[model samples]
Target: MHETDVAIIGAGPVGLFAVFECGMLKMRCTVIDALDAIGGQCTALYPEKPIYDIPAHPAIAGGDLIAALDRQIAPFAPRLLLGQRVERMTDLGDGWIVIATSAGETVRAKAVIIAAGAGAFGPNRPPLPGIEAFEATSGVRYFVNKREDFRGKSVVIAGGGDSAVDWALSLKDIAAKVMFVHRRPKFRAAPETVAQLEAAAERGEVEMVVPYQLHGLAGDDGVLRAVEVATLKGEIRTLPADHLLAFFGLSMELGPIAEWGLGLTHNHVTVTPATCETNIPGVFAIGDIATYPGKLKLILQGFSEAAMAAHAIHPRVFPGEALHFEYSTSKGVKTA
Candidate 1:
């Protein structure tokens, strides 16, 4: 078992930032994440994707942001408990809370903060026969972990979401032949990306097959021969391909956190925006997992919530202690 001032439930951008905030108030923190590494979904899902709304940076890659956050909190030296999902949390009266993880590790802290964004997420796979066979063999990929894998190969992409459009445009120059098949004429990606896909289609670099859904997949143990699609009119067509990429988005679950008996609204924890605290005293919620009136699910907003939660949590950890909040520039990070 370990002990800290705060036990953050997620190690994403918001949770990482909270470590910095808590550190400023001389509070030790332990960040727990189900993933083997930090950065949560940002690192696990789209590490190469670009984010435009982070403060001070016009645009930054997802992985870069996580790296920067890791650096910013390095001085704090918060303990990281990764690869373990929080299994249970118990209030130990007198303002102490004990949290246990799936790995059987336990941590006692004065406060708990839930910064899990969309909770545990997994890609929504397409409903096709033998899809799992290809999935296990790398013939079918739900995400573009490495763009070079599709180099000089015939690729068929399914879905009409941002991931589908983005990957289509991203791999257009690398793949020998790229085809995008969707069930609707319109795409759910950004307008600019949709325009780029259209321009690529017009240039004959990409084949656009609309009003079609994935019917089946033709492949062997680990080899993909082609992708079969069915039109709305019941017409079936096959596209020869070496790889099939499906971007049907993700499925999110709150998991064990939902059983904690916190006030929940639409699967999100309800918190008072002022304190960023939930119905359970000494337990706070921030980032996308926290919802209040006029809440905007943005990274910057979560940063502000993290600050508020840290300030509110300070009093609980050290009873009757005066909190004189100072800017980082005023009193730079203090190293132990």
Candidate 2:
């Protein structure tokens, strides 16, 4: 068993930032995550993908961004409970909470903050026969971890969303051949990006095969050699390919957190915008797993949510202590 001022669920960017915000307010935190390491989806999904929206950074890879966040919160030295999923949370009526983990560990804290990003998330795999076999052999990859690995290779990208369109453009110059297959002629990407894809197709850089669906894959021992596609009318065609990249978006589930009884709106925890507090007292939700009216799902917004939640939790951790709001310059971080 461990005790702290706050027990934060999810060790993603927002969760890590919460440690700093709470630390700056003189609150100690215990961070819990299901993954063995921090960074959550960024580390698990696309670590090498460059994120352009992070403030003060023109461009930063997902892994590097998490590394910077880890450094920023180093002085706090928050306890990290990794490789365990939060199974249950019990609010101790007296403004305190007890948390239970899948690893059979317990955590008692004054408050709880949930930063679970879309809960447990993963790329939605397409319904294809023997797809799992190829998936295990790297013949089919849903994530683009390292772009250099696809260089000088033939890739068959399927889907009409931003990922399929973006990756096609990203690997067009690197891959020996880029074959894009989609069931619809229209792409669900930014218009400018779609225009760029069209231009690339015109220049013979990308081959656009529209109104088709993946029919079968030809390979030996889980190694891809060609991709077969068929039109709605049953016209089939085989395209040479070394790999298949399927961008079917991601599927999100609340997992065991669903039974926590917090107000849920479309798998997201309902929170008051002012303090990021959920219906349960001493329990708050932040980041993508939290939702309110007119909420913009962005990391910057999550950072703001973290600050609000920390400030709201400050009073609970230190009862009867007045919180005089002050900037970091006034009271620098006190290291452990």
Candidate 3:
């Protein structure tokens, strides 16, 4: 059993920032995450993708942004528990007890913060017959966490969303042959990204297959060799490929937190307007898992909410003493 002033459930950007914020307030923190590393989706989903709205830099890769954030919070020296999932939370009459399963190890803590952004939405695979068998043999990959693994391999990507297009563009120079297959002609990616992909296809850098869906997968020696696709005109065609990558966006699962009796709307924890406190006392929800009036799910907004939640907790933890204050450009006097 370990004790801490706060325990964050997810080690994403929001939760990592919360750890630093709490440390500045002279409070101890413990961060728990399901993945082997921190940075959550940024590191796991698309590390090579560039982000433009991070405030300080005009553009930064997802991996680099996470690294910078990790460096900023390193001085805090917060406890990090990776590959852990909170099974249940109980009120211990004094504070709270968080019971978690971390790589087969049982752990406990106080004051849990749910910062799980789009919680554990596993990869979406195409509805194709024999795909399961192919996947079991390592012929199909649903997530593109590692881009270099497909070097010199024939790869076929499915989906027109950001993830699919981004991976396609990133693998163009690495993979032996890269092909993008989308059910829609127009992409849901950014205009610039879509244009770049189109230009790549025009220059023979990549192949584009539109308005088609996968029907089946065929392989040799338990490894994918060809893909069967169904055209919009009800025609079937076979394409040779070494690997199949599906980036059909993710579907979120609320997990046991949804049954914790916390007030929720549309499967998201409901919180107060200014402070990120939930309906339950001493419990707060931040980042994408939290929802309030006019709440927009963004990294910057989550950082602000985490700060507010920490301030609100300081007074409750120490009822008599005057809480310390910090000057903020947006909000004048904030207690920590």
Number of the top-ranking candidate, with TM-score as the measure: 2
Q: Report the Cα RMSD per candidate.
A: 2.2, 2.0, 3.9
Candidate 3 has an lDDT of 0.80
Off by over 4 Å in 2: 329-336
Say which candidate scores most in lDDT: 2
Worst 10 residues of 1 by lDDT: 44-53
Sort all candidates by TM-score, best to worst.
2, 1, 3
Give one digit per residue, the lDDT tens place, for model 3 in 1-336.
777778888998899888877766777788888898999988887776666567888777788888887886777788888987776776666666655554554445446678888677687777877788788876898776577788999999988887788788889999999989988789988788899999999999999987788878988666899988888788887889999988887888888788778898998899886778887777789999999888886788988988888887776556677975765454332332
* Candidate 2 residue lDDT tens string, 50-118: 676799997688899999999999999999999999999998798779999999999999999999998
lDDT of 1: 0.90
- lDDT of all predictions: 0.90, 0.92, 0.80
**Model 1, span 127-199: residue lDDT tens:** 7877888888788988765678889999999989777888888788999999999998898887888998999
Candidate 2 C-alpha error for residue 112, in Å: 0.8
| Candidate 1: regions farther than 4 A off | 334-336
**lDDT preference between candidates 2 and 3, better one:** 2
By summed lDDT, which 10 consecutive residues of candidate 3 come out lowest? Answer: 327-336
List runs of model 3 lying over 4 Å from the truth. Answer: 58-61, 92-110, 320-324, 327-336
TM-score of each: 0.91, 0.93, 0.85
